[model samples]
Target: MNNIRNWLMGILAGLATVFLTVGGVRYVMAGGEPGEVEKAKQAFKSAGIGYGLAALAPLVVTILRGIVGV
Candidate 1:
């Protein structure tokens, strides 16, 4: 059970990271000159992915804690 919980946490954390990073990159790129808007968008996407991961970390931690009965 503990092992399963750990695996699930890892997967969830990874997903969150990817999403937040992508979103961030897109958001950042959304700025800048209109011509470079595309490039900026890409960066913002990454940034978003990072943010998502950060948000997910807490949830993952909580689940892990529960699994360990802590």
Candidate 2:
């Protein structure tokens, strides 16, 4: 169970990093194109969400543990 928690936290953090990098690349390559810019914005939004989830990973693990009686 502790290993599961650690894995979950690591995965979430990694996803956040990936999203952030993708967002930055998209934004930089957008080149003022409306559609591309919109996509970049969405990517940034997803990155924010990923980061938020990463931040909440510990709490989430705790809740899951409680529900599972671990």
Candidate 3:
């Protein structure tokens, strides 16, 4: 179970990193076009949320494990 948790955490963290990097690239490549900028901003926001969720997953898992007496 601990190994599974570690794998899941690693996958989520990797995905979050990918999202952040792609979003950053999109934002940088928007080139001042308003619509493109808005899209890039939304992507960036999603990346931030992904990163935050990834960062919180371990804490959440720990709390859940404690609650379930795992």
Top-lDDT structure, candidate number: 2
Query: lDDT of each prediction vs. the true structure?
Result: 0.61, 0.84, 0.77
- Candidate order (TM-score): 2, 3, 1
Question: How does each model score on TM-score?
Answer: 0.45, 0.87, 0.73
- Which residue pairs in candidate 2 collide? none
Residues 1-70, model 3: lDDT tens digits = 5676677778777877777777678778889888877877777777777777777777878888999999
Q: Cα lDDT of model 1 overall?
A: 0.61
Better of 2 and 3 by lDDT: 2
Tens digits of per-residue lDDT, candidate 1, 2-61, equal 565456557756665665566566556666656456555655565566556655666766
Give model 1's TM-score versus the native structure. Answer: 0.45
Q: Which lDDT value does model 1 have at 19?
A: 57
